[model samples]
Target: MGEFELIRRYFAPMAKATKPALDGSGLLLGVGDDCAIQRVPANQDLVFSVDTLVEGVHFPLGYCPRFLGWRALAVAVSDLAAMGAQPVCFTLALTLPAADEAWLEGFAAGLAEAGQQFGIVLAGGDTTRGPLTLSLQVHGTVPQGQALRRDGAREGDLVCVSGQLGDAGAALEFLYDTAPATDAASLLQRYHCPQPRLELGIALRSMASAAIDISDGLHADLLHILRASGVGATIDLAALPLSPALRRIKGGAAAGFALQSGDDYELCVTVPEQRWAAASRELQQQLTVIGQVQQEPGLRLNADAGMVYSQRPGFDHFSIT
Candidate 1:
């Protein structure tokens, strides 16, 4: 099948299905265009971010196409979530080894489901012949002055993360059979179907002092906020959130994963003490306070006697072997 034909068969319908429902909203033009046009509402600033995922590096050798479709878009939109942006639309660039019809069908179905979930539409994209890789550029918008930024953290701000951590890390073990358990559905879901903290990020608008989505491991991504704001933090080890599945199935690695596992897609935010109560009420117990921002310039973990300095690198795509 030809490229345009492939798009028509699988992707064009996604755009067409949602076009009329929009009734001339944020996305003006979608699909079959050299460029997609969108309208930004007054007092809102446009936000854009692109993410690329290659087979093997980003996923297993033969991950489910449908889940891959959802995950690819979820990870990209997580950037918008981090910035307190409401997802608008996205463009995709897919490279495949072949025009596998079955793969395309499942992948498109998954993509469509995620699009609906995130309230985003597919604008336009390209398909090329090569090693399988999915690149998506997501567009969003945030209120002019309320966009969350990483450089606004202040001393005494509380560091918080949404949802329990370590589930994804435990799930990774099962993917390769490195861990002994085999009946971990929730952990596997954590790995395959990461839920981006979109609502929480949007709610964080003026409440959070600074924020970032935890794409890398919790420690690694939180370090980004600290560095950007020129601040430091002290995280209590006991306060790290661990899901029941992770604690029960992969107990030994629970702490490690919570501290260093990647792909959680949860939000790590810093909010001032005065705002903590308001933020707490807003989240409605969906978040946990794990640490506190400080004037010092390093990350510390609480220990029995004192704080332990840590500089461990998170998942690095280009780590030296």
Candidate 2:
């Protein structure tokens, strides 16, 4: 098929079927127009998430196309996971220097695999010629009044995090500087293919008052929650979770990277003190308590003289760096 024809046949048809928005019956409007239409069911909340991956910025050249496709979708979906929302659908926009049949095939296959895995359909998107960039906007839904928000945290709530941190950052370090170790395979995988903690988010909806995804490092990500919730936190420096691989090379430094390097995609959540035990037990496989919410309105790290780690900010797309 010719390029435009291929898009109309395969991509356009899919978009028409997936409607980005919804109808009166709560059915989603996925793919037919310039924008997607979707429905938020009665008594349900809608979650919207968008992420972009640039060739030179987000990934290095020569990175596998299949993995890039998967990572693009996964990164967007991680926001839904942070909100305790059910995967619904997504729209993709691609900018490329040129189209290659083999590359498209591989990319589509990877996107298809992730779509099926996450129960999200590719509803719509645009393709253009430019520097390689992939952007995805995803929609997820949660029961009415059940989606978690960054502003719902309360003072004295327990602060929690899902899964190990720093692995992705450590992996990036290796990806750019040196060869990855045999054990570092998992870290590299974590960097490339982070699994959004959707299951845990669903489980925590009722228990967690506030939540945010760890995309721009824990310190910055958590600040969103703190600012919104009007609270502060005291994280134990000794308690930051590091993968076994990360611990081997740079011990505490890895933990620091985990705290500030960004792109972890783990969920940082806050639950009332009373709900801690139950939340912990229910999400034991996916969560761990890192600290507690403070009545004070400032963030602090575990250190002598009450050190604050928010000094070194996380990645900002607009930063002058």
Ten-residue region with minimum lDDT total, candidate 2: 18-27
Model 2 lDDT per residue over 204-285, tens place: 8888999999988888899999999888999876687777887786654656667887778899999887777665555665
**Candidate 2: lDDT over CA atoms?**
0.79
Error of 1 at 199 (Å): 1.0
**Residues 88-166 of candidate 1: C-alpha lDDT, one tens digit per residue:** 8999999999999999999999999999999898989999999999999999989898899999999999999999887
What is the lDDT of every predicted structure here? 0.86, 0.79
